[model samples]
Target chain A: IAGITQAPTSQILAAGRRMTLRCTQDMRHNAMYWYRQDLGLGLRLIHYSNTAGTTGKGEVPDGYSVSRANTDDFPLTLASAVPSQTSVYFCASSRGTGELFFGEGSRLTVL
Target chain B: GESVGLHLPTLSVQEGDNSIINCAYSNSASDYFIWYKQESGKGPQFIIDIRSNMDKRQGQRVTVLLNKTVKHLSLQIAATQPGDSAVYFCAERATDSWGKFQFGAGTQVVVTP
Candidate 1:
């Protein structure tokens, strides 16, 4: 089963450019999340959606925005990417508030 | 923002030995905690989890302990193997939104054969 998949396994973007990381889950879960992982730091939640059509800001959502248009897809967009936005991004989905199934990750490098 | 900090950045242990990793969270409203193992270039994988109502919970060779009183959490691995070498992360869920999970810095484990 394709639990969770993220598009653009890796990307290089110029600073100030806008980019969207695509995420899809085959599990049909209600809760979806976006997180960024940096060296020497754990994954930090960017945004989360408890259900379709609802999104909420997470710990680090200043430069990121997420939309849950449907149950299987939750996309995270980075507006005006900066050097500090360079990190590995992961998308995860879970049923209700239960355990999460995560994607391999999309590595973004901002120059 | 509340911090979920780990006690150690790296841990080295011999194969077959038991290993313990510790974490401390600053949020008092965290109701759920989870341990995740991440290998290089991979997303974190759930190892075990413990709720605030329970002090300890065990899985195959892994165990998670939660101390709500101290806002501390720990993961214990028995019979550590070389395959267990990876970074371990501890995460706590906000009571307000269960899907909002905050993670700690993480501890890298090196199991020497």
Candidate 2:
């Protein structure tokens, strides 16, 4: 069903560069989220959107931003990526509550 | 300030044996709890979930137990197989929140054949 699709499965970027991780969901869910996963740290919310044109900051929202202009797409942008930003990024969506459907993930490495 | 955490960082189990993973949450207001399984390079996949009103929930070969008094949660897998080897995380959602979830560090399960 292609529940969620993420672009650029893996990437390596130089420090201080800008990057954007793209996500799309065909499930027509009302809520979407961006989370980063690091070794031993688990998943930390970066940003989230309850619906189109609405956004909110999460636990670790610094240095990253997200926009939900429409229900089908939500993108996460790293304005000035740092080495510490090297981690796997995941995009998720849910109808309103309960379980979340996550994308395969985008692995980014900042050198 | 409220967060979810796991009791163990890693666990090893023999195939066909039952495996248990534990989790604890600090927020008493959390009403929904879920367990997710993540493979080597994939994102976390939903396994099972339990709500505050219920003490236990079962799915396929997996069972989730919740203890609100102690703020404890557990996932039990019966007849564990090699395919069950993965990182498991516990997530909690506050009663007032719509979709915001707080996740634990996660426990890695290794099943030996």
| Fraction of the true interface contacts (Cα pairs closer than 8 Å across chains) found in each model | 0.68, 0.72
The parts of candidate 1 lying over 4 Å away from their true place are B1-8
Measured by lDDT, the strongest candidate is: 2
Q: Chain A vs. true chain A, TM-score per candidate?
A: 0.97, 0.98
**Model 1 error, position A25 (Å):** 0.3
- Model 2 quality (TM-score): 0.95
Stretches > 4 Å off in candidate 2 = B1-8
Question: Which pairs of residues collide in model 2?
Answer: none
Task: Summarize candidate 2's per-residue lDDT along B24-93 as a digit string, tens digits.
Answer: 9999999999999998888899999999999999999999999999999999999999999999999999
Query: Which consecutive 10 residues in model 1 chain A have the weakest lDDT in total?
Result: A37-46
Best by DockQ: 1
Query: Measured against the native two-chain assembly using Cα atoms, what DockQ does each of the candidate structures obtain, in the order listed?
Result: 0.61, 0.58
- For candidate 2, lDDT tens digit of each residue in A1-105? 769999889999999999999999999999999999977777899999999999999999999999999999999999999998999999999999869999999
Candidate 1's displacement at residue B84, Å, is: 0.3
For model 1, state the Cα shift of residue B90 in Å.
Answer: 0.7
